[model samples]
Target: MTEPMFWMSVAGVVLAYAGYPAYLVLRRSLDPWPVVPRAWTPPVDVLLVVHNAGDALEAKVANLQRLDYPAQRLTVHVVCDGCTDATAAVARRLASGRVRATVFAERRGKSACIGDLLPTLTGDVVLFVDVRQTLAPHALRALTAALADPSVGAASGELVIRDPTGFAAGVDAYWRYEKAIRRLESATGSMVGATGALYAARRQLIGPVPPGLILDDMWIPLSVADAGYRIVAVDDAIAVDHAPPDPAAEERRKRRTLSGNYQLLHRLPRLALPGAHPLSLRLWGHKWSRLLVPWLLATALASSALLAAAGSRLYLTLFLLQAGAYALAILGRRSAWLAGRFPPARVAAAFLSLNASAALALGDYLRNPRAHLWQTTRYQESGR
Candidate 1:
């Protein structure tokens, strides 16, 4: 039983990283995403949140103004949350016609600020975005029309990481895999969440996020979906942001996000409960299983080592393979030759960092959920 369980854990990892994505490509090939016509133009509120994004606010505003959507039907609201810098000032300077700016004095977390401010906005659809990404000319229109099905509660746009240098990064590869998963989920009309960088929701579905919560993307879309509406992914509506320059930053971001997954399952236990959600199997396979990856990896490593010690040739080979990959990850961190710029190093490094982050996130979750929550709010206040 132990040996079988060990192999099962190994199979889970393979299925996750390999089989799942292939299944999506096959599923997509058989049934592609439905075409959403651009004709369904509706009043859109571009709700942008920023901290100290003074450097990028003006250009981002300009980018939005360049969008193909009708100016009369579109309104841009930039909310500056505890921005000590000239973020609000820059936005206010850029504010003209349909663009507006508001400043929040307190350093509340984004979820709280958005929850508080969402009530004041009146648009047929509220499109949420961060200050970093710049959308394509017709991205907004595509997103709006995706919701024309009326069955869609929210529509999440694809994010394209700017890799102009064509540098190979593990997170870049991961996003490609993630995009396929999103497409599969969208096909079933049960994508679990939206990309916070660019996604739109029905105005009526907009509501106050829970206090002390992070990951508004996951929470908001799930909330809307619970009301019997579908969450779809729109690959045509693409937004661009630069990829993280280093694995350290990527790990930090993943840690924060993984920690929020814990909180999400806690806050909305029904999401993980079988028969509770249409996406329950997918959630476990795509999202929640990820939370167990570190453990799965560890168990696979230990079990193989144990069996190898008892003179199993196959387990010995597996053990050696695991050891070699982990060694490569350590080398990737220390040597420039083995760094994230190359595919092997990047893939190995990304795998190592991701599992390490999962362990750290789980540790943080266990140690002090409230304290971590407090720290996250502080971080989100400054860095977002």
Candidate 2:
């Protein structure tokens, strides 16, 4: 085994999980861009696109109504895309001067819904919220307020898992860690992207939404940065949802998202490494590096095995440690009791599942597939 290959593989793993996070912390520590939240609540319009979401449509509408923003200032548009169920009915029941419902006879997917909705939005700020989460009363206000800073074209709210007692707790913790990185990245210059669960963008800045499976969150934020604007993360603006009871549903959701990342990177070539994309540094270390991790992991294992066979005692120990971590992952899945008792095991397992999902996502990207239309991963788990 070449020593350089072995070291590079090790470095790749380090850079993705540890090095990048460390860099974010250090960068934020050295130069903090303070974002003072303002009371200037611009007119916020919510465009909610749904496909076969009849079960939770009423609850979603209720959540929208409950947000702390002014009744006159907040408008909700629910677009039911080919939903054969009571999705349209629920939306119609809740429709009023403040709430409106749009129905499409055929399913063209989320991208199509977004494309149709963008032109109709007249508010100063347009918020895109997924049907799966309920926004905290202040989510709309905080996200919209951030746009008061002219440099920030878009802002994403923090998605918080409302409950955390089972296997899902590890998943919730994982997101918390991710939010931390986003906060630092936003402070430094621009966050690599926004969360679709709850996020807002200046109406003038939003152009045509890309058609197909590309992630709107990443594309919109990156496009904003490309147009000389920044995307900030609004931590206090929280959107709450139930984490999946198990990793199965979460894996499917991640597969779609990670694949979209792969597809978006290709669609927007400027975001790739060695390109002039202003967010290239953050994208490379934070985003592309994650896409490459499964391969790096395989290389690390093989290289370590070869080195061990060649009598390198240190490599042998490293290989054993890797093997043990995988063992813990297996245990985490097979025994919930053990996982609950030892949280570290569950976190390690979730990490493995995430990377495995990324590998599946790469395959999905290669197949040149269309995005799934409005299938919330944990919809069933949430019992909505």
Write the residue-wise lDDT of candidate 2 on 306-372 in tens digits. 8889999999998898899889987886677877889988788778888888888988778857664
* Minimal lDDT window, size 10, model 1: 373-382
Stretch of 10 with least lDDT, candidate 2 = 375-384
TM-score of each: 0.90, 0.95
Instruction: Mark the regions of model 2 whose C-alpha exceeds 4 Å error after superposition.
Output: 379-384
lDDT of 2: 0.82
Residue 238, model 2: lDDT of: 91
Best by lDDT: 2
Whole-model lDDT for model 1 versus the true structure? 0.78
